[model samples]
Target chain A: MLTKRIIPCLDIKDNRVVKGIKFLGLRDAGDPVEVARIYEEQLADELVFLDITASYENRKTLVNLVEEIAQNIFMPFTVGGGIRDSNDIRELLNAGADKVSINTQAVKCPDLITESSRKFGSQCIVVAIDAKKENDGWQVYINGGRTPVDLNAVEWAKKANELGAGEILLTSMDYDGTKDGYDLELTKNVVEAVSIPVIASGGAGKLEHFYDCFSQTGASACLAASLFHYQEYTIKQVKDFLKGKGVSVRQ
Target chain B: MIAIIDYGMGNIHSVQKALEHFGAKTVVTNNPKDIETSDKAILPGVGAFDDAMSELKKQKLIAALNKHIRQKKTFLGICLGMQLLLQNSEEANKSDGLGILEGEVRRFLDRKGFAVPHMGWNQLKIKNKNCPLLKDTPDNSYVYFCHSYYPQPKDKNIIAAVTDYGVDFTSILWQDNIYGVQFHPEKSQQTGLKILENFVNLC
Candidate 1:
């Protein structure tokens, strides 16, 4: 039986894990390896590390961080945020990333998705879409949800699937940092549109929010950052809550 | 010592890291002598089948591996590495496998409502509970999987476990000193680590 996955995402900036990731397990906010171990202890099925650092020099640090975290933990993890081409994907996978999520570059040149998936298996390529509700439908957002692309969320997801993307990471721009809840309508649209696994990101204020996204939409995995980072809710708590609701989770 | 065969294919770093976590001495090399000398060997692979087989041939590790397996040496194969143990694969046009196991690697059909790559965590239904790799693990344990194709063995007795995507496909295959898992044990979290630990201890 395939179980729904709970993923905790860590955003790395300047070669350090950003956000106040203060925890009993972590020595500091910048310790990606320590933070990753704690999440694994909490039984996170998978992890996603976003390298928000844009400089070439800092990329070396991010690569090193990925290697350290991969060494420390045994679960699959994805690296995203500023991946440009197939070569970039190869470098990170060599460093031990299970998958690479591409957003801006994918929208700029859709061929990047095809090429990356072709070179590396589709299982290693994930296309992330940061979407915001526009006049009538959801429009894709890029550059950390600052710039809006003239693409529909559902259409873009469908196109990504056609291009051989293994999975779709759909983050709702409106729900991000709001801590309200996920855009179920948007998530449902993308999930229904794509044949691959869809990871619902952003929002996730409460435990029920994770359950709501899983039960309401066809998302195979749900991702949260601040909630888990702040220690408000552990991955175990969320999995137990979902398990109570009769949702299949790795318990 | 354990040898991780480096066939110029996928990254074997994570596999090495996982084995090292268990305090096992490991080496990543294409040299056949190293593999033959080690108590255990792991064939870690990713990407296309033809390319991987070509690289193994180029390095002249295929014949060495065949001899090592014939000697009943402890061997483990992971993901594409596991698939390569079969007779042939449908990937990369058409390619012949090592023929160590009598089977063919077939692609997954695009069934309605089922993903092709079969990415994410799924439960393993143990077929042969006596298999050493299933030791210390539950009957239906969740393991990570990422592949568009799976192995179809000619001899079903070698299959230790199976997972259902659209069909009941083989997840783990074992016979004597040889073992293979379709999923990435290095990426399957604690359950994965336990599997690796079991393999390491088999020596």
Candidate 2:
């Protein structure tokens, strides 16, 4: 059976791991490689490194960091943030990243999704959608949730799947960093909207939150940052809880 | 030394890195000469079946790989590399594969809730505990997988292990000198590393 994935997202800024509440007021976490090794030890199903580095010039550091992490960690990991074109995707994959997540570039040129997927295979292309609940539905946000777009969340997810994206990293900007819980409704809508696997992201506070997202939304995976970063709950603890709850988790 | 055949299909770095982690010397090459000279070779790929077959042909790796396997040298295929070992695939257009294994690659049917790609960690039920590739690997151990199409071997005796999603599919296959895994052992963490190590330690 394909078990529900438990991912630990390491938001990178200036090559250092950081976590922010609602994508603001970032706090230092630790070194990327070191934190990654710790997660690997904790039996993390996968690791997501979101390079929040601001300057395009510093992007080379991310590639170097990815190579270093790949050398040390044997588990599958994803590199995202500031990935603009096919070249970026190729560079990351060559550097040993199993997948590359694209945000703003995907919206700016939706063709990137199709082109990259065609070139590198859809399994390696992940479209990260940052969404916030609006009027009657949710609107998509890009540029690390700083800019709002006219696209609807569910529609964008379906469009991304149609555009050849293998997976959707759906993060709720409203629930992000709140430590409340996942946006079950938004996740469920998107999961139902697309046939590709949907990774539910943002607002993972407790063990039950992880269970809730899996049970309520049928998400293929759940990604958390601060909850695991601060050592409030270990991945083993979460997986154990889920296992006890009859959730099919990789133990 | 192990040669990882790279036909420009997908990433081969992780495969090389994982093997090297087990202290196995590896070279990533598209040249047939490298593959021919290596004692063991790994065909690691990701992408559509036809594209991979075309790339392998363009690189002239088909004859070299078949020669390597015919010579009774150990050969392993990962993901699309595994699919390419079969007779043909039903992806895109009906296309021929390497024909080394008597099987056809088919896409997963659109079940009610099962995803097509069948991504993430899944347990393996080892059928052949004597297979060297699964030497120390325990039954029901989890491994990483990401693919929409899976190979259905005509010879069931060649299947060494199987995994379930919506159906029980051949996750690992072994014959005399050729082995193929639908999962990415390099990216499957510890159990994956163990399998890679087993391959590396094969004499």
Candidate 3:
């Protein structure tokens, strides 16, 4: 049986690990390679490195950083942000990233998901959805969560999966940075809506939050940045807590 | 040298890195001569069976791989590579495979409710206690996996280990000189590295 995964997300800017609170107020955490190495040693099931930088030059630096981390670390790592086309996804995969997450571009071109999934396998195509609670339902946000699209979060998730997205990285804007907990309602709805694995992101503040997300939702994985970047809890600590709660977690 | 057969399929860099990390000299190549000259060969693949087979044929690696395996050479196939060792796969419009192993690749829908692509880490239930590749690796050890289909080998004797998602399927296959795994050892972390080390030290 597949064990629940504990992933530490690294938000990268200019080749450095940066943490953004509610998608704002950037703070340096550490070097991408160094922080990735630590997460691997801490037994993080997987690592996610989102190249938060928008410039073409910074994207190159992120690729270089990905190579450095891949050379030093052995676990599966995902690279996201600024992935515009299949070529970008290929470049990152060739650079040693195990998977590539597409958010803004996937929304613009759902065929990009189909094309990439066909070129590469669906195993490597991760579609990330940044969603904020709107009215009674969640609305999809793009362009670093600054723009709200007309698509509904649940509806878009279903569409993304139908378009050949292997996994869904669902982030609840309402709960991001506040760390109250993952938006369980949104996560559960998304998980039920999609057949593929759903990774519950944003609003993970405490160890119990991890347990709650896993136990409450059908999420295959839980990802956090500040909780891990700030060193409030190590990956080991989170896993230990989950294991104690009778959740099947990889050791 | 351990040659990682890269027939324009999946990323072989991580596999190369893992082997070299354990002090094994390795090369990722598609050249028939390079594959033929290596002491052992590792076939790592990703993507559909039809495309993988076409690429292997395009690169002229199909013959080289079969010849090497015919002489009882050491070999390991990961994910799509492992599925290719089977007779055929249900994926990619029921494409034919290498026929190295006597079996048909089936999808996970046979057992409902489980995810189609069995992604993330899973435990191994040892079936072949004496399999060299799993020498030090404990039973039920966690290994990373990402695939929609699992091999249902015809001959049960060749099975080395099995993992259950919705159905009990072959996770590891070993027959004489050829070996294959449905999971990615390179991505399985410590236990995965240990399996690669065991494969590296295999006599």
Candidate 4:
């Protein structure tokens, strides 16, 4: 049986971690490699590093950071944020990233998904969808969730899978930062829409939230940022809690 | 020194980095001479079987790999690299593999609940505890996997370990001098690292 994954997402800006990590006995919390090492120590299943740098010139820094992190950490990690073309994906993968997530580019030019997936393998292409509930349907958002697209979240997920994306990282804009819980309906819809793995993201406040998303939505993985960044719950604690709940988690 | 084969298919860097972490000197190369000269070699790959086979042929590594194995030198294959060890794969249009091992790569059936690709961490049911590659790797230890196709060996005795998704598939393959793992040991955290360490220490 494949175990559910617990991923700790780290936002990167200009080669450094954006969100403050409050891990104890750490020299530099903003360092992506250091923070990733801490999560690796906790036995986190995987890590996602989203490069949120605004400028285009900082892309080189992101590549350098990925190389440094990959050299040090042994666990699988995904790098996303400004992935535009196949070259970007190639550079990152050559730097030792296991997967690369694409967002706005995927929506702006969906052919990128097809081309990159074919050039590289579909297993390394992840389509990150930032969605917000609109009326009864969830609408896809791009440009870091500041702009809305006409694509439906569930439909987009299916299209991404069709476009050869290996996985779907579905994040709910409404539930993010609130820590209320995961967007179960949206996640469930996307999970059902695609045959590939669905990683439920955003609004992971408590241990139950992770369980709820996995148990209720049939999500293959759950990703949290502030919940783990604040040291509220370690990854081991979350996995242990899920284990007690009869959820098959990687221990 | 270990030779990490770079056939321009998948992420060979991660494999090299993991081996280096265990203090194992590694050289990433596509040249047949490098692979033939090395005491041990690792074939780490991702992507479709047809493409990988073509790339390996384009780089002229198939014969070198066979020579290395025929010499009784240790060899390990990871992910698609593992699949390429078999005789053929059902991926794409059903292409031929290296034929080093008597097996066929089959895609995971579309079961009702089970997802395709069988991605994520899965536990290993170790059948041969005596296998040196599994040293310090406990039974039911979790390892990272990402693939739609898995190898079904004709000789069950060669299977050292198995992992269950919708079906029990061979996750670890071992014979006299050749070894293969369907999982990405470099990305499987401690258990994966332990396996890599054992492979590195295997003389």
The candidate that wins on lDDT is 4
Candidate 4, B1-203: lDDT as tens digits: 89999988867777888888889999999999999999999999987787888888888999999999999999999999989999988885646999999989998987756877688899999999989999878899989998888999999999999999979999999999999999999888888889999999999
Q: Point out the worst 10-residue segment of candidate 4 chain A by lDDT.
A: A53-62
User: Model 3 segments beyond 4 Å from truth?
Assistant: A20-29, B110-113
Native contacts, share recovered per candidate: 0.63, 0.70, 0.59, 0.70
Q: Residue by residue across B111-190, what tens digits does model 1's lDDT show? A: 65576678888989999999999999998888999898999999999999999887999999998998999999998888
The candidate that wins on TM-score is: 4
**Model 3, residue B71: displacement in angstroms?**
0.8
lDDT of each: 0.88, 0.89, 0.87, 0.91
lDDT of 1 at B120: 80
Better of 1 and 3 by lDDT: 1
CA lDDT of B128 in candidate 1? 96
TM-score of 4: 0.98
lDDT: worst 10-residue window of model 1 chain B = B111-120
In candidate 2, what are the lDDT values of residues A63-169, reduced to their tens digit? 88888888888888999989888988888898889999999999999999999988888898999999999999999998888999999999999999999999999
For every prediction, compared with the true complex, DockQ reads 0.69, 0.74, 0.66, 0.74
Q: Docking category for candidate 3?
A: medium
TM-score of chain B of each: 0.98, 0.98, 0.96, 0.98
- For candidate 4, what is the DockQ? 0.74
Model 2, residue A125: distance off in Å is 1.0
Tens-place lDDT digits, model 4, residues A1-251: 89999999999888888888998999998899999999999999899999887467987888888889888898889999888888899888988898999999999999999998877778889999999999989999999999998999999999999989999999999999999999999999998888999999999998999999998998999999999999999999999999999999877
Off-target runs (Cα >4 Å) in candidate 2 are: A20-29, B92-95
Model 3, residue A108: C-alpha shift (Å): 0.3
